[model samples]
Target: MLPFALVASTLNSGLVSASSYKPRASVCNGHAELCDRSYGNVTFIGSHDSYAISATQVAANQDQNITTQLNDGVRMLQVQAHSYDGSIHLCHTSCLLLDGGLFSDYLTEVNTWVVANPNEVLSILIVNSDNLNASMYGAVFETSGLDKVSYAPTKATTSVADWPTLGSMIDSGLRVVTFMDNSADFTTVPYIIDEFSNVVEDAYNAVEDSFPCTANRSTGTPENQLVLTNHYLDQVGSSTSIVTPNKSKLNQTNAETGTGSVGQGASNCFQIYARSPNFILLDFYDAAGLAPFNVAAELNDVSAPTNTVANYTGGDGSTSTSTKSTASTTSTSSSLSGAGPQFKSEMMPLIVAVAVAVMAGSGLMLA
Candidate 1:
């Protein structure tokens, strides 16, 4: 199938899987940058960035040369994006969220693209920050009633899950995202975990609240899944199934898996979501349970199990239950204003002033 692409939009999907790349400089003869490719040991060079496109670049298809390389046996679409606009997302200012289009519209487009371009575009790569400067992005998925990808703040006093980006992604089917415990004793890289849960819930309630009623994690698989593909994303046996996650319960082996390299998970995020066997709950439990693997970069020299989208794992571990509800599939977005007003800023912005002084006098890298 001709992979589902995020085309026809006004803004270019930015550059696929890159912020550090300049087309002319990165291309070697007629190929993509060596760094931009490589999913585990699989050698990925399909559609690079599917979500973060810029208009002019979009029109030109700067990545098509590599796409041609994928002509015969393309199985994954690798995407890459930085979380913040550098100076923007950090300071407390309102700005456009990353998923630039309307959440409903965007979701609809994804479904359409998946249908239109089957098997080729399987996964999504999210190398951006969790908090965008926009609120609409946050509101639609995590907030109450909005249709855009607006940004919300990772407020000084906000709950981690309530951050605008997390809420929206979760609402949009992000199943799991567990960084290192932040306090684990393992010497792993600080990583980022983003599991795409296709359950697609209302930003207003828990995924359990919307349609089916699945239990929380620690217990076995939620009862809501056995009969359905609720949280456990992949089928019993498919090429996409993961081979060596925690260890092999099947062969009774415990040789630990390392952050071998950036594997096929990120290289196939968007394309795989199209089919049912194409999904996997995103998670980042410390193989050693030491720290959160820092997922902010594309190829961080962090540690083993480096960064993956939602690749399969070997062995049929456990399963969720089947205690569900008769729910409606209608779209319903809510607003964050209902949670009371956004926090009013307190101090007169001393941090900005201080940062400026330090940068100006110290020749700091903050610029």
Candidate 2:
């Protein structure tokens, strides 16, 4: 039988080997500087109009399900909710246009994911089209079991300096943060953060030529609070139909690549605001080879997984697959390679220390 010290050293060595074999976790996992950096300073990939997804084109913002988006590393979900049939539901503009279903159902899925993956942090930005009070949203969260894990900021509005670190929030078990565009009554439900006071987002329906770095809704410089970059492109369609011409072009150029792309829009905003955008909202998140997620990882200086896009099964029982287009008109090839700033330099030393500890422990057991 193995001696006591030998058994413990073997178990420690086995644990280190197993963890090292796992894929690198989220960039925000380690490093106090990155984790404690103001929430406004961190960058997240956001899905614009996230609930408007269907097999058929129905004023869609995203082409896939919420679970798929989360799996692909979307940290922020932006949806419009309205009071429908006594309860709040996720809809686009109006229920007559597109209804994604009950808000509680959506929150349930999110809650399940949150509990399963304790390391991940997520945010929900709701456009309260119905002007429902904060309690209305709070009830849904409570019912869905999401409230238990929600983060309640001490202040009604969080300044750039007041934001907590991602690590701290995770450690405290308050990982899901929420914001509302309107009717966010902090007194009633503290977790329902006021969007306008904390985040400045560009116009949602801006044309490619008109997309600017100027703040439209929120006031003050980007340094004062968090900022969102709206990178979706829309064209004029009939009242009945919102024609998104050049969708392929929009998806191709909207990543964090070169200028003229919507991803470049972030760099443009950075130049004007003097701080990088915290959330980059994109339509057709899986388009152009999942460019939004790739761009987000790059902006945050993390290693992105292989550039793989989801094969979207349409709402109409049809199937459409997305592949990185080799034919890109934008400044650079739309197929972005893993060429971004790396995580904090201290990560290497940390990994080495773990390996050394395992080896030294094993040697001590032999002695």
Candidate 3:
């Protein structure tokens, strides 16, 4: 059976019935010089655990859906693909732990966005958790019609300086660039570029104080490879299963402060590489205002508006959760509103979960 078969019947029906929403404007607009820079020179805000957005404690890493993420100016999408029952699904660690629906569904949404936004360049990083060959995953891209616009390097390895400009890529109709963390068989799927060859990233689980600017995993030095900075902090817990952090606190403090902030993260990395990072991965990028994009603009020496969009609010306009808005190519006010959770951010999720449990227990006691 196909992966979509595993989707809950009600949810599958909703997805099928919902009208296809068109994507927002391209984030790359008005930055023509960005295209002139090396691929490694560009900075992208990546979605960590891109598929984990269901809101369940074990599974939810994001507050909104994948298309919402894309529409919010996230240029790089990082996901884990696992093969289950002969079909691929986007999951975190294991499909049983966090099944994110069909891999085809994801590529289809991306394909729709890519087709609508012709000028933008998108990057995808896949963690081959199941160790499936490139062709296996490539087949999905092919079927989704993404392969038609996918970019293949002319050689085994291409340096930042040699990488085609964003405009050049768009003109050539090669808009999508793919990277695989493992099991990349370029012979079978040439577009599935091996990630380590072109990029180096810091450890994903790094805390704020010891966050090393140095490469945790890379084939070469930061000077030679594109720097991917992993800036999200995991809430300290006794176990990984209980480590989910509060999304709002993540938006305010981590996304706004010290080493976690896009400017500071870039600054910390510049100390080591003599240049800023190429990719900045965040958990809730929508809450960071214009910090990420503005930082990228500064690094690229291009003009960026000082203003940022208003911070997103939760579904009920309450602090129970948070969500982001559609992408905006233009700028708004530059002030960092510092708007976020009224309660402490980090422990909010656990608190909410615990509060519900306590209320349930109190009712049981009365009964």
Candidate 4:
């Protein structure tokens, strides 16, 4: 059954048509120099738990939606997946805590964006907390039409140096790269690659003010894999075990140059590993405006973008027009508005009980 489904998905998977051989992109990812650079060599600013977006939700990791993040030059997006109400959903920790939406819906938005931006390459990292089968994810991708633009490598894992240039990926129309942190079976779902096999990462869920450059989670040879630096700071949330983004530290954490800054963390990794990190993941990226992007640009040797789209202010759930500002480079501790809805200490037990009940009823094991 799985084989048949995989075959069906592949046939409908809208890989770049052979007849429509487009010319190589002159500018890839906002830079002509990056067009010729290997996709693995380029540095990209990433949003941590990109789908957990809200201006008022306590569990929200981002203030803007996925489309806004992409438009503002966030090339990589990280999402946490879990089973909820008999379907896959983008959730944080657990659905009872924070539910972004259905996985298919999320992919549809991404598909729409990828189709509209032909010259840009995007990457998505899924943290499969529920340990769902790769084909289950492949099914969602197929239904959402995201499979149309998704990239499938010839092998399960490719060395960093062997990756194609960004221009080639864009020209081929296979611009979206998908990675799964766990339970990724490439033989069944070729487009969803295993992340640890191709990428290495620094520590995550960090609470320390000082970010370390040492490898914390990696199965692949560090030298042969792309580097991903987890640069976000965390703090104890409603409970001692529950950790949330340290919102108060956003200005320093996402700054271009400072102690505990993204720049400093990336630089530390580069000095120890002898290469720039391919991805630097952050929370509330809009808090410090384009600071993360500036650090990435410096690492990539490209000029930083002059302006950025303001953080989402849509309180009604409808997509709102973002105002552009040239003053994004300056540290913006003041722009970190709305402390968000606070989680009551008394609600933690109830939330945990409900989450456990839901998981038990669905026969899904939590990670």
Using lDDT as the measure, the top candidate is 4
Which sections of candidate 4 miss by over 4 Å?
Answer: 1-23, 237-239, 312-367
TM-scores for all candidates? 0.21, 0.74, 0.75, 0.81
lDDT of 1 by residue, 134-182 (tens): 3222332233222222212222122211222212232333212222101
Report how far residue 81 has shifted in candidate 4, in Å. 0.5
TM-score of candidate 3 versus the correct structure, residues matched by position: 0.75
Give the clashing pairs for model 2.
55-314, 55-315, 254-263, 255-263
Residue 309 lDDT, candidate 1, scale 0-100 = 21
Q: For model 4, how does the per-residue alpha-carbon lDDT over 130-202 read when each residue is reduced to its tens digit?
A: 8999999999999989998999998998888777778788888998999999999978999999999999998
Relative to the unseen true structure, what is the C-alpha lDDT of residue 156 in candidate 4, on a scale of 0 to 100?
90
Please give the TM-score that candidate 4 achieves against the real structure: 0.81
Candidate 4 lDDT (Cα, 0 to 1) = 0.74
User: How high a TM-score does candidate 2 get?
Assistant: 0.74
Higher-TM-score candidate of 1 and 3: 3
Backbone clashes in candidate 1 total: 67
The lDDT ranking, best first, is: 4, 2, 3, 1
